[model samples]
Target: MSDSPLFQPFDHPKLKTRNRIVMAPMTRKFSPGGVPGANVADYYRRRGEGGVGLILSEGVGIRRNGSRPDKAVPNFFGDDALAGWQAVVDAVKPTGACFAPQFWHVGARPDDTTRNLPDAPIDSPSGMPWPGKTVAEPMTEAAIADTIAAYAEAAANAKALGCNAVEIHGAHGYLIDQFLWDATNQRDDGWNGPTLKERARFAAEVVKAMRAATGPDFAILMRISQDKSPDGSIRLANTPAELEQLVTTLADAGVDMLHCSGARFSRREFEGSDLSFAGWVKKLSGLATIAVGTVGLDVPAKSKLFDSFGPGELDEVERRLDAGEFDLVAVGRALLADPDWANKVRDGRIDELIGFDAKYMTKLH
Candidate 1:
């Protein structure tokens, strides 16, 4: 095991890693035809070979047409896509790196720019992307059941592909998040409730269905954020107490890990407690959590909405990691810009670590 706290080995029932550094799930629309091929597998294999503890792959669409506007993003469905993912898993296995795919759907944020079905209704709890402008109808009971089963099938696919874990992209204004936030999920049905825990039913149902399909060995990692990607002012939980309740619901729903998303992993979540988002989630729910933000790049908090980021937080992240603030630290743009981020940190090559340039965001590298 590595001596550094951040570099220490991690072992969970569903996943294990050589270190505590996880390459955060990032969106790179490089998979043309929605099928990850040799290039895609190589991209991840390089990171695994470089020393990333766990690799949560880029968001993969579960819908037939895919939920994202960019058709280049990979999909978890279809025989071709699954075969492509098999190659990815096969490539990563030799590196001994645990991996997972972030199951995703864009919900009402339909990509009208892409080749979408003519007049096909966008799938959302209320069919409202934002506060107003209802572009489609709310999800019917049948549709809701179908979406839940779709998630379950996707989780099954991950397991069949030998994925160590599977993640539900319940954050950043996506489909699952649409069910989470009140502004989007305006349904008065069972999916919506008077309390935070009750309102969390849709997400919990998805979790339950996934757990049933994947069984005990496949770990479910639920990624959640306080605010949507476009709206930081809106939060899933107004108070830390509510945050605790919401997180507990997922834990009770059988989530093995909480990929707590916040602006920064070091910033205090509330006024009283100095604990970060991951800290509060872990403390309140007693589930393992991954802390993520701008660990290598000095970005700004909420710079890209709920994706809070900024400089001078990496040292704080390290301190908190040593102090047990979070179990693992996820590096997003940092790892995207520099694949050797883990190796550099492991070898005390901090001085040589390159700063993130904005240009790297447009390229897969």
Candidate 2:
């Protein structure tokens, strides 16, 4: 127990940490045409220069047209995308920070209006994600195989482009999250079934494919959460026991580090337990963990994106970090509001911390 969250180091054999703070993967939506450019490079470089130990690139689509909308988030597929990501990597490397990109697929969450292209197909675990609306049908066996291959290809490309690692976006009600959630996943095929292990089958296969592609040294991180974004649906092993099982299975499947996401960092995942969701998963899986939420801000980071406000408290975070419940901490909106946030906190200039506003989220270079 260090008695402070602001400054602490996490030492895990798989995850090399320069400091205790991880620049959480916050979607900047700045990439133009799914390609990261100089502006995106500068954005990340600034953060790294300011002392962000590890930088998780925004949710990069595994394939073109796989995202929720025509946003600026970069794509990992294609030669152009690879070159663009290389630029980002080149920019961040000078700061001597570890970097990884979050590989993602939006699944049924994409709207026809948001996709920009009307013909882009949105796939799901089942033909229907919710009632009365059909975006696209469930993935056929061929489609599933193609997706797995795409992940492997993208991972290889990432390694080629000099990315230190890759994170499979297995959370937040995205493609993988859709399959993990029982409500969205109602298929009876080999990929989907009632058993938890079966639900984890697809993700496991993708991980294995990526592992073979990236080799042994490059780290592979996994991001998971109990709640999904957009509607904030509870999914992916909601209970603590089930969460333990889920994390254990993923760890066994080859995740080097587990980034447990949540809306609030301090709250315990299970009732009657002092351990938070990250705490529980770290304890259960015995892996390096990064805890992320509304840390050190006046408002909950995503309130405007949805429709709500979240409680604010830094003392609670400090208390938890002192207890050694989690290895690393992720700052989303706080870092977005101020790129030098980590430096400020470390210099004991907490009074200079800025609150994030919704206006900043839409601005992309």
Candidate 3:
């Protein structure tokens, strides 16, 4: 176990962890009325006690009318919701795990008409959730400014709650991704442009605002993906040079780390290179990167979104981590199925690791 880099400690100027295992943020919609209860706090506490080095809370909505599709998704603003999150932090910190709340906004993604804010105006860059699909009016500059401010406010709240860091959900075809993708952002304004770098203005500004709110010591992480929602083959940057430009823009704007999401962590990101998405991002941005996707599953996440899969060997992941391909490894479904995943791996209890079942998603366990 000592030879495996997965158990090694990770140290950075703004972030440090006992091990390299991170609990990837997965939406569990358990918080009622946008406020997490004691159950939510206990759920996170178990992960910390189970030995996860870092735990990123589920996607908590920012202070915007249509920031989330469902009221049960939890919120990062409001006194009641912030108080609920304070309890969560209090519970997890005692177990020796660093915590961060993933601030999110769904953007042009369709809402749950029956249970969500059906009448609220959904915010999008150009009102298109996907290419050639317009559902509403483009986001006005004023609305955009307000959204950015809301993100900054959330970051300040997280810091005040004693969180180690804050993550901005910029991946998975959410509001921020909508602006980054040219197909969804067709506005004839400063926010939209032909080049990917130009399209990154909105994300850059968000990072910059959050940086000012949290000060220099607090770490700010942004999640990015080549695959956008409703389309898995989407590539924000076709080549490494293009990816460098986009990431460097965010790095310049004050992103302390990058969480690169992929369907399979082992898959090569581009031709002629074995480096994965997280590897390339770390190399380009010169910032810590978290590699996530199917860390313990035999099948890719896209292939088994709602089905159970057998356990996968982590020799490759250990090799990559030992090689410094990425700084951290995030496990989602596996951690959901077994909170003590990190401990089991550390103890060389490979056979004891549980396989992920879809049923685990329905409850806090």
Candidate 4:
């Protein structure tokens, strides 16, 4: 392996990744009937066998009616789903890469109303995707309690099925993110008070519950992003101080690490501060966090601005990693394009690494 910090081993109480490179969770609707089968297992096994350090599975729905909006997206709970995931764990374990499933719920998504649960009511913190628009009634206390329990139970199942870690999908305008964003969560209750800490309470409760359900060895990761999808205007915290408060509350509640997401990983998170989102998180929480955006690539994933079909490079990523800007690096489309990304880099075969291509994304590589 090259003498880069990104190639070093990671040994923590909660996880022991083979290296500091992580495969970010990217959704693939390959599973049918919400069940991931042999193909899914083989898909992940290929990545593990290809030399990824850790593999974070795509957003998997819990055992709730509204958990998954797409029938093709995998579920984390239920007999068939768990069986499929257990097989996946078995398949990937031999490659020495740890795996985690990201729990997800698309609360109040206007488009997903009829996808997973046609008749089941759509519910969010304030019954809207944003302010001044009502998608459904505000979630009842019982509904909120059930959602939290579902998350905890899912974590327990993941632990039992030999998953090395678990991630709560509290990002990208999903259910948990709905609770974090002020525009979506306008509740006056404990879940939504006037401050960022208050807004984090519900998500904290879910993490605390997951912590109680799983052992210390079971690494728990929480993914949070300032901007939601499409809209891009939503932000959980406006300033560094606000971000500190928000992440601290969740960390204190029991999150082992944070997966900070942005369009550009190393870009400045705020004015007059050069710290990236993950940098601020690592500094504020004193916990390991994943820095994700674009690595080894010039354009963001799913971007329409494909002028030259970028042959992405990694000099900037290596510089930031060597500088200790973030604890770990999460590569998304780059890894998807070339499964042996980490291996090639470790072997000093930089020329072998490929760039972002739309064709590679056609399948869930």
State which candidate has the highest lDDT. 3
Cα lDDT tens digits for candidate 3, 1-365? 75579888899899999999999999999999999999999999999999999999999999988897788999999999999999999999989999999999989875346335777777899988888778888998889999999999999999999999999999989899999998899989899898889899999999999999999999999999999865688898999998998999999999999999877777689999999999999999998999987788755333246334333658888989989999999999889889998898899887898767777888898
Q: Estimate the lDDT of model 1.
A: 0.82
Which run of 10 residues does model 1 get worst, by summed lDDT?
Answer: 300-309
lDDT (tens digit, per residue) of candidate 4 on 1-365: 56878788887778888888889898888999889989889888988987889999989998777787788999988899899999999999999999999899888886754558788877589888766777888899998888889999999999999999999999988888888888889887877987889889989999988999996657899999998986666667888889998999988998998999877777788899888999899899888889987776755455452233333446666777778778778887888788888888888887777766777766866
**Tens digits of per-residue lDDT for model 1, 125-214:** 898878776878888898888888989999999999999999998888878888777778899888886678877888999999999998
TM-score of each: 0.94, 0.92, 0.96, 0.94
Better of 2 and 3 by TM-score: 3
Give Cα distance to truth, residue 129, candidate 1, Å.
0.8
How many clashing residue pairs appear in each of the predictions shown?
4, 0, 0, 0
Put down candidate 2 lDDT per residue, 272-340, tens digits, no spaces. Answer: 887888899889998877788887676655546544546556677776767778778888877877888
Using lDDT as the yardstick, the better of models 2 and 4 is: 4
- Model 3, residue 171: C-alpha shift (Å): 0.5
Judging by lDDT, tell me the better candidate of 1 and 2. 1
10 residues in a row with least lDDT, candidate 2: 1-10
* Deviation from native of the Cα of residue 178 in model 4, angstroms: 0.8
User: Considering TM-score, which of the candidate structures 2 and 4 is the better prediction for this target?
Assistant: 4
Off by over 4 Å in 4: 112-114, 298-313
At residue 57, give the lDDT of candidate 3: 95
